[model samples]
Target: MTTPVEPPVPPADTAPPRPGRKLGPIADGVGSVHRAWLEPLRHTYLTSGLTLSDLSIRVPLAKSKISELLRGCGLYPRWEIMHSLSIQLQLPSWPLHRLWRQAAFEAQKSSEWVERSGDKAAVTTSLVPPLDHRAFRETVESDYSLYAQVFLDDDQRDTAVSNAFDILWLRWNEALASPDIRRFAWEALRATVMARTPHIDGRPEFGAAAFDTVALQHLTTETERMDQMAESLHLFKAMSWLPDRQLDVMVMRRLYGTSPEAVSDLLGLSLATVRSDERHANHFLQSVICPTPETEGKTA
Candidate 1:
């Protein structure tokens, strides 16, 4: 019998590219809403081993359009395209639909436009939130509301907190996979509130907000009020200069009277780290607001 000859193996350099290899990372400077949904879609596409051609066939989008979507280039995609892509990728459609709506709003698309396009997508899911998500919201809502109210009116504070929860819902899978869900949630909440907060000289401006603080509002005598206002101004200025983590610790521990253990849990920090941050913040504020002769001389 004649011996069979095997074909030569291709060199690694000349081998065919892996599925989805041409899909680049999402473009920089995409808005948060775009980043939030694009990341998971990209991840799902990569893992699904689907190439652009395959996706184009399955998603009713052109290959070039699919490429643009994966890279976050071109115009913000409509809900119909996103829904079709999500179905092909086997991703949950509800979160993507919500994120699409938010992105549409960010893009200055009107409610009528969103509703009309959403009608085209024809996506529907239960209105009820997941039990764990609801529990997480309940657990953090009080502290988050209080913190936001420090920088915003009641209406604005509620809106910020609600938006934060919506963001968390969009990234629920990633949050669950994170090392600390509390820290993830805290960051989302902080970003949402700060995006609406007024800043001066790159620091959060507290002048007007501080005047409305419960501590300041409760002062009775003029002398006491004047003294308190002066001290508070100095304190808030110094507090603004504190590093972000230390500032958070100080706000929770001193301003809100949260226990170290609770602050630790809330911030996803260890108790020791919380205590250390508290001590450091206290020392820094003291040095700034009440410098001794030696410190004053050094600064001078």
Candidate 2:
């Protein structure tokens, strides 16, 4: 009780340009799978939908080649692979086109999330105002560091981090909260990342694929859920109660490990003032606002 992808014909207007150009087999609707094909193909056939029965007889490729190409493999054929399949099946092109677009969108997002993190410096730009520039860099850096440590070797770390990035970026809200901002970041990030890592697939380790996949999926899921529960902007306002200078002091000394002189130069404060401010911020966070959790079972 299922339907299959409809066949597609070349758009009517498709033609070779100019005199002596000669009519060409237009390739429109060639490479992409049509959306009408999604359910039946995915549910029943997977890559096996292109069976070379009498129905598949007229497709350009031989039965064996057709079978090989059914999954939409490594390289896209110069001709419309999907279009031929559609013709063989005698299905309409509309649904197949829709499915192809959907798959393209998903593949784009997946590439963005899993493939870009090998270059940690690429993520530093701020998209808008009211951004906690420090926290953003630190958080992304921490994620990168965690990934680097997870593998500990050059090839493993590089591949795993790249894959992890693509996996994370596809979820949208992990980087930007607003939908428009998310779209913009996703597009820009996708283009740049894909350019940088042309051959990345974002599958870190065969053994940990399931864990890594679920981890990133739920990481963003929880972030969105928690952002809602905590009321993001409201929480931001509440956190702003900490004086900017004290927050700066705590961040430099504790979070950054910057020396007092470096802190003084960065914050435009004197050495004495930097030391005093650090002491004050540390004392306040330790006692009033933030307390260190017990490290009994935690690493040093």
Candidate 3:
């Protein structure tokens, strides 16, 4: 009898449908960072030989609040509260902020994807697409302000995002080895910011003094480079004064050259809402530059 012949295998893409992919590092990293922060808080109490009650007294927080934080109740303290703890514990605020931001980002990303894609199981079960650094950055870059806005003011948020990318590049090798590369880069940056924060005297406060300083730096007949840098810095300081959401919307739409529809998608806003935000942001800036009588009257 002739040997039986088998049909050729189908292309891999034609294989039977599989269940959702594992989210892997996305879920794992978020939880790990949460624990990372909580454990240190608990350790501080332990190493100081203070009970939760005693710690509450020093932190000026309720014992229950301290307990909730220690237990990871999903509510992070405000920066002011963290700052207080940092002072008492001599721990840098940067690490806690960094970890907290990562945790928040991951949680929000998972929730938003589930909502948008209507794939609840995939997100909640940690069964989603295979994520890599480029995909992760693209996913998070749009609403990066969401995670960052929690810890940084509007002006600082853009700077922080830019800085994080730089940090990621500087530590590419180490970051590549991380179970969650994005989280690792962020935490590294947070540590760097915290470490350096103590050495820096102060940041440029948004005020007349800030503008005056910039003006003083301008040459009587500036080179093209100096003029460009001065203009850029002036605009940055001006933009910083806008409301948080407005600033975020403006930065993504203008600086990144993202389209309005794309901006809406990224920011989870309706098309109309995105346009309105941009309009309002621009109006606010224009009003500052050339005050309408109405605005001047309100100011007066």
Highest-scoring model, TM-score? 1
Instruction: Work out the TM-score per prediction.
Output: 0.79, 0.23, 0.36
Q: In candidate 1, what residue range of length 10 has the lowest lDDT sum?
A: 1-10
Q: Candidate 1: lDDT over CA atoms?
A: 0.76
Better of 2 and 3 by lDDT: 3
Looking at model 2, report the run of 10 residues with the lowest lDDT sum: 203-212
Per-residue alpha-carbon lDDT of candidate 3 for residues 235-276, written as tens digits (9 for 90 to 100):
655566666567667766744557787666554455676788
Model 1, 29-115: lDDT tens digits are 787666657766776676666788888788878899889988889988888888898788766677678777877887788998888
Which sections of candidate 2 miss by over 4 Å? 1-50, 53-56, 78-80, 98-300
Q: Which model is ahead, 1 or 2, in terms of TM-score?
A: 1
Top candidate (lDDT): 1
Under the 3 Å rule for N, CA and C atoms, how many clashes does model 1 have? Answer: 0
RMSD versus native structure for model 3: 19.2
| Candidate 2 C-alpha lDDT tens digits along 109-183 | 344433232123222223322334334333343434332432234454444344333322332232343323322
Off by over 4 Å in 1: 1-29, 32-54, 89-92, 123-125, 293-300
